[model samples]
Target: MDEAARRRWHQQHSGSWLQLVATLRNEGWEAQVTCEAAPVQVEGTLPSGERFYFRARHSDVSLGIGGDDPADIAEWEASESHQEASYLPAAVGEAMIRRLARRYLEER
Candidate 1:
């Protein structure tokens, strides 16, 4: 994504993340999201006491599940980081994040 596109994607993705916080909370998880800045972050605690954490900046995302287990943590970013990952088109990156978030919530 070019600078303009990246900015757009960041805004769009950040908005989507914001919208998710409410739905997630309704699912019995205390999903709180902070997307006002780049590298939006979200952390939640499931009703079962399981912890969930998510961080996304542009097309790159890192997730933590199962608490403190290194094996349970994963990062997926086609471009690696903000500078390198800017190549991902906004639509593609947005779709990826949506899918990933859905799966995470469903599994939880």
Candidate 2:
């Protein structure tokens, strides 16, 4: 993808990313955002000390929790906090798919 295509792709994803940030903040997560532009990144910590990291890019998005203490890790391992997605909906045109693939390869 060229520069123009990359910019367009990132712009297309910005709204959903912003909505996600707003929802997280509303849920009482103290969030620190790296940027509001393309490839939005947020690190959040809840009152209970659970930490969350979220990253959204035009090609992909990821969410992860952080726990470094040994006791906390053990407790979490024994806890019933696992979740499975029954369905994840995605709509991608051929051009988008191509762009995603190109971005993935470039990042790697």
Candidate 3:
């Protein structure tokens, strides 16, 4: 892709991460996001003192709580500490963000 296309793609992904951060904050969690490239990252702290994280690149999304030791998102997902973390094809698009946010609110 050209530089322009790459920037557009990054912006799109960053928008998704920002949406997730906003949703989490609206739901009472303290959330923040960083999107320097493909894998946009979100970190949130629940009212109950739990640390939550979310990372996504393209169609791959990973969500988990704790284990701040990972060097990167992929490592975090692969770590045994977050055994439940896994990628799903359904994790793409706006709808997936809503679904994941709902699941986070419901499950966490």
TM-scores for all candidates: the values are: 0.47, 0.39, 0.51
List lDDT for all candidates, in order: 0.55, 0.44, 0.52
Q: Which stretches of candidate 2 lie over 4 Å from their true place?
A: 33-41, 55-108
Clashes of each: 2, 0, 0
Q: What is the lDDT of candidate 2?
A: 0.44
Q: In model 1, what lDDT does residue 71 have?
A: 24
Per-residue accuracy of model 3 over 1-108 as CA lDDT, tens digit each: 999997887676566657756776887788787543455556666555556666655545655655453224322232112222232222342354455545656754
For model 3, where is the 10-residue window of minimal lDDT? Answer: 74-83
**CA deviation > 4 Å runs, candidate 3:** 35-38, 56-62, 66-108
Ranking by lDDT: 1, 3, 2
lDDT at position 97, candidate 1: 43
Worst 10 residues of 1 by lDDT: 75-84
- Across residues 32-93, which tens digit of lDDT does each residue of candidate 1 receive? 76443455566766556656565556656655655463124533212224442333333443
> What's the CA error at residue 57 for candidate 3, in Å?
7.1
Rank by TM-score, descending? 3, 1, 2
